[model samples]
Target: MSSTLKVGILGYGYATATFHAPLINAVPGLKLVAISSSNATKVHADWPQLQVCSTPEELIARTDIDLVVIPTPNETHHALAVKALTAGKHVVVDKPFTLDTAEAHDLIAHADAAQKLLSVFHNRRWVADFLTVQKLLASGQLGRITHFESHFDRFRPEVRQRWREGAGLGSGLWYDLGPHLLDQAICLFGMPQTIYVDRVLQRDGALADDWFHAVLGYGELRMILHASMLVAHESPRFIIHGTKGSYTKEGIDPQEDALKAGVRPDAKDWGVDETMGRLDVMRGTWMQHSQVANERGDYTRYYAAIRDAILHGAPNPVPATEALQVMQLLEAGMLSAREGRLIRLHH
Candidate 1:
């Protein structure tokens, strides 16, 4: 419970650049003390003052580091997280937690055994559009959600030569974007009663699935989760319909793009995108719409929560168990897609 918690970040790829660095820099009581990356050139160029290592093991072995942020490839999350927890360091692993629920459970077991704080970086839950949706729902504007559709589409026709675009256990859009969208849905409306899925590899040379459409059955409510790589244009990120009215918002969160361009988390226009999403509603016989500015997405909160949880006994913002639930949903989605059957969830 030191006043300044020293932190170490693993990997310097997209996750590290777009999330770990900026957010770590923004949070109080958390100092970016060290980093581990095979190619530390880029990270060193960005933060020259920190101690840079060549491996995660070396980083976590250092007693000076109290917290470790794992932003490695999807296949490595479970292993790295378990290792960090065993090293007596609080850990933050990026989603989707693991390839399956078994691996997630194993990591959870290790974390619990070590009595370490483990959390997942489900940053999409803090997206401006999601926050806006929360506001709308809290206002009781979209009464008793009957139908909901959320899309996390992209227009990358050609599969880049990366782990994510390959045919591996944790590759593809299902593993890459599934956790973000699904976890947000789970947070808003508890786990769905049942799930049905449809998945496809639209591109010619694509080795992994690039398109997926999942339907979550909640009695009278049907929630659709969609993601595709070949979409030349994307649909609204959120579309909700209820008994009283409907809300439609089209646009993606700006934080990712901001962090990519070396924009620090504390920038004045940090989460601002001129093309912010708009909400359209249809109530009774009248149609009403307003372009509400997307709420400011504060990634800083994740680190802040971690600091408080580790130092002040506050609850972990994205608990390891909550992440396991997301992994369960992802596994169920994949299983349902392959078997062409609906998955009946247990509690």
Candidate 2:
């Protein structure tokens, strides 16, 4: 492999334009060489020097490309990743790995057969607030967490005419946002023993589910993962209650907004979130409340690690097995919602 890996993105859609392209360019050893998109004009608007292929097949067939990133629709992830792996290129698929667990398994088999690196883009693992929570828990500041709640709420009252809001297989809040929350929870605490989900379409004329509440049970601990499109008031992004103390944080990570605003990842203050989390603990007889500074998030670390994995045999940043675990939880959550009962996970 060359010292600099050439990368080709499969789509110029929202995920690609906002997250993949910029982060790929930010890393030193990864080169954003080309993009496969029908709209060459749109591709050139942001990346004027990039070679725009008219179709995904053209990009995958290019001999110069060492890595292929699939940031297309959720349903297309498995197929595109298979193609990229068959072409002997390292593959990266945006989250919700695939529409279902079977598809995810198929993609993993293809990558393994081809002897190539396969990774999923679970970018939220590097979110500023999440990193802070990870550090806090590691320090034993929040001892033996008993309850944890994570929310990804928004106030989009109107259901827009998009694939995400349409009545498609992978076009709902559960499939769209559930992966991030599930992946993060699995990172903090291993796979849960059981999962229960309640999904609903709360907005008028909403063809797909716009709200969901999922609970994962880990022995005595209860984890709540929720998302809603009708929340008008701001809610705590994370709430944790442990035997020793509690930690509550507000506001989402600023990286996504910064990327949408065309801010480069190399910006001096990139991923610096000013919103501090409140940490409350007992001080002998009184409860003490203090502010905990957030840790900076850098999505570039993901791609940088991927580059090293391909070039220097480093471990994959987000391995296929880890992503497969997330897919299993995703499917379990759906089943729990459909059956209106708790779904037990078997290892």
Number of the top-ranking candidate, with lDDT as the measure: 2
lDDT of 1: 0.85
RMSD of 1: 1.7
Q: What's the lDDT for all of these models?
A: 0.85, 0.94
Model 2 lDDT per residue over 1-347, tens place: 77999999998988999999999999999899999999999999999999999999999999999999998888888888988999899899999899888998999899889999999999999999999999999999777999999999999999998788999878999988999999999999999999999999999999999999999999999999999999889889999999989999988899999999999998999999999999999777888999999999998989989999999999999999899999999999989999999999999
lDDT of 1 at 14: 76
Q: What is candidate 2's local distance difference test score?
A: 0.94
Show pairs that collide, candidate 2.
Answer: none
Q: In model 1, what is the error at residue 331, expressed in angstroms?
A: 1.0
What TM-scores do the predictions have? 0.95, 0.98
Q: How far is 273's C-alpha from truth in model 1 (Å)?
A: 4.4
Cα deviation of 123 in candidate 1 (Å)?
A: 0.4
